[model samples]
Every structure is written in C-alpha cells, then in structure tokens.
Target: MKEIRQQKKQPEVIRKRILEQATILVSQKGISGVSIQNIATAVGITKGGVFHHFPNKKNLIEEMFNQIILDLDQTVEYLIKRDQTEYGKFTRAYIHSSFIHQIDGVVSAWSALSMTMITEPTFNKIWMEWLKNRLSQHAETDSHPDLELLRLAADGLWLQSITGVIDDEQCSKLEDDLLNRTYLT
Candidate 1:
C-alpha cells in the first residue's frame, strides 16, 4: 500500500514541478521563448516525460492558468467569508488578494508570469470569463460606482507595480488606500 501510494504521488509531483518550471521560464523568457522541451530541461525530465503529463505547451499554459484561478478563488472566498459587512466585500477581497499575490513570496513568481499570460489571446479570454462570472455573482453587493472605481484603481495599481512604474512603498500605500475606499462604499 505504501508503494502504491508513492507511485500515485510521483506523477502529481512531476506535474507540479513542470508547472513551476514553466512559470519561471515563461516569466523570464516570455511566452514565445518557452517550450515543452525547455520546461522538460528545467524539470530535469525528458521531453516525453513532460508530454506524458501535458500533451502540448497550450495544455501546460491552460493548466497553469487553472491553478492560478483556483488559488485566487480560494483566497477571495476566504477573505469574503471573514468579512462581516456585505457592502463592497468582493471588491475589498479583490484588492487584498491582489496585494497578497504581489507581495507574498509564495505567489510572487506567479504574479509576474500571470501578467504575461493575460496578454495571450486564449489566456486573456479565460481570465475575462473568470472576472465576468465573479462580478456577476457579486453584482448585488459590488456593483456600486464607488466599488467599481476602487476595483479599477486596484487593477491599475497592480499593473503599475508589475511594470515597475510603482515602487513597493508607494504600492503599499495605494493598496491600503484602496482597501479603505472599499469601506466607504
């Protein structure tokens, strides 16, 4: 039973490693520069081994996106649940989640890579669909003009931070300001 459990765990471990390496490579080299062979080489696995888990580069990108979305969803859900007020709850969670992903070392790499991925046509669509669904779900509470402005501001701040146009100190202040704005809405 232990041996069988190890066998089951190994594939999952490799798949995760592939996604990690792919994120790093894509962030450093841009989307066009990374390939299945590049990911395999980084993971110290054969091309066929990477292919065994991901049939192509697109599949790998999509899987990476899925993982990112899942993380964001969980973070937002947790933050929303902890909040007592319904007003602007989703927008507050979004701003907090954005800053968390940006500053938190665990997901900082993904922050940079996600900016790149969002530019890709397919990934862009996937991201937009996710945003649309989330917004629709929270329309009753998050549809206010003030909340919408705060959300857009948070997005702009996120873009500025990733592009190096906004320094860490300034970003923190702006993030705090946005969170405070959510309370007013």
Candidate 2:
C-alpha cells in the first residue's frame, strides 16, 4: 500500500519539475529550440525522467499551451471583477498588463505547434477550437459588434510588442487610442 502511494506521488513530483524546467527553457530558448535533454539537465534529471512525465515533446508543448489558456482565463476573471463591462474589462486587462511579455514563452510554444499543425489537420482543428472558446467568452452573444474587432486589434498590439516591433511609448499611445475607440466615445 505504501509503495503504491509513493508511486502515485512520483508522477506529480516529476510533472511539477518538468513544468518548471520547461517554462524556463521555453522562455529562454523558445519552444522549437527547447529539448528534453535541456529540460532534464535544468531540473537535474535524466531525459527518461522527463519523458516519464510527458511521453513526447508534443505532449509537453500541449501542456504548456493548456497552462497559457488557464492563465488567460484567470486574468479575464480578475478583469471582470474590476470592471463590470466586458469590453472595459478586456481592454483594461489586455492593454495595461504585461501579458505580452509575461506569456511570451507560451506564445513561442504555440507558434511552433502552429507550424506543425499546418500539415496535420487534426491538431489545427483542436487549436482553433481552443482559440474560439477563449475568444467567445469575451464575445458573449450579447457583446457589441465591434467587440471582435477590438479584441483583434488588442491581439495585434500584443503580438507587435512581443516581437519588438512596438516600443513602450508606442504601446502606451496605442492603448490610449484603443480605450478611446472602445469605450470613451
């Protein structure tokens, strides 16, 4: 019985360690470049140990994407609590927070996954479904027609910032304009 209990706990411990190391590697090297051995070394474990938790690289990438989804959900909830209006909440949370920089690692992971999915239809469907679900929440049926456009614009700005195409001052101005167009009018 004790052996079984220990076995059950082992997976959780291994998974936690993998996630921690994976997050760091993804952040520093981006997803395409991160290797199982790199993660294992970072966590002081063997490659087989990392594989024990996640059977393959794709599984690890998917888990990282799931974490990003969860993080976004939590941030949305936080925004909802602060602002009663959906548009207000979304705009404020998206524009003001450093989500672009904060989620860069996850974004990089997704980018890599996206490239692979181009040839694999199954993965593409799942990825789109996940994205639609996340967007749909903020785009509840009652939301204004412009809500989708606003969301797209915010996403573009975020992408730009992450790619180093936009400066801090530019982001600030863009945020102001987005707020004005979205709510101030």
TM-score (all chains, Cα) for each model: 0.85, 0.67
Q: lDDT per model, in order?
A: 0.80, 0.63
Cα lDDT over the full model 1: 0.80
lDDT accuracy of residue 71 in candidate 2: 61
Candidate 2, 34-126: lDDT as tens digits: 899998887778999888888898798678656654665576567667875555555555444434435334444333333345433455676
Candidate 2 error regions (>4 Å): 1-14, 23-31, 86-88, 91-124, 138-142
Give the worst 10-residue stretch by lDDT in candidate 1: 101-110
**Top candidate, metric lDDT:** 1
What's the true lDDT of residue 153 in model 1? Answer: 92
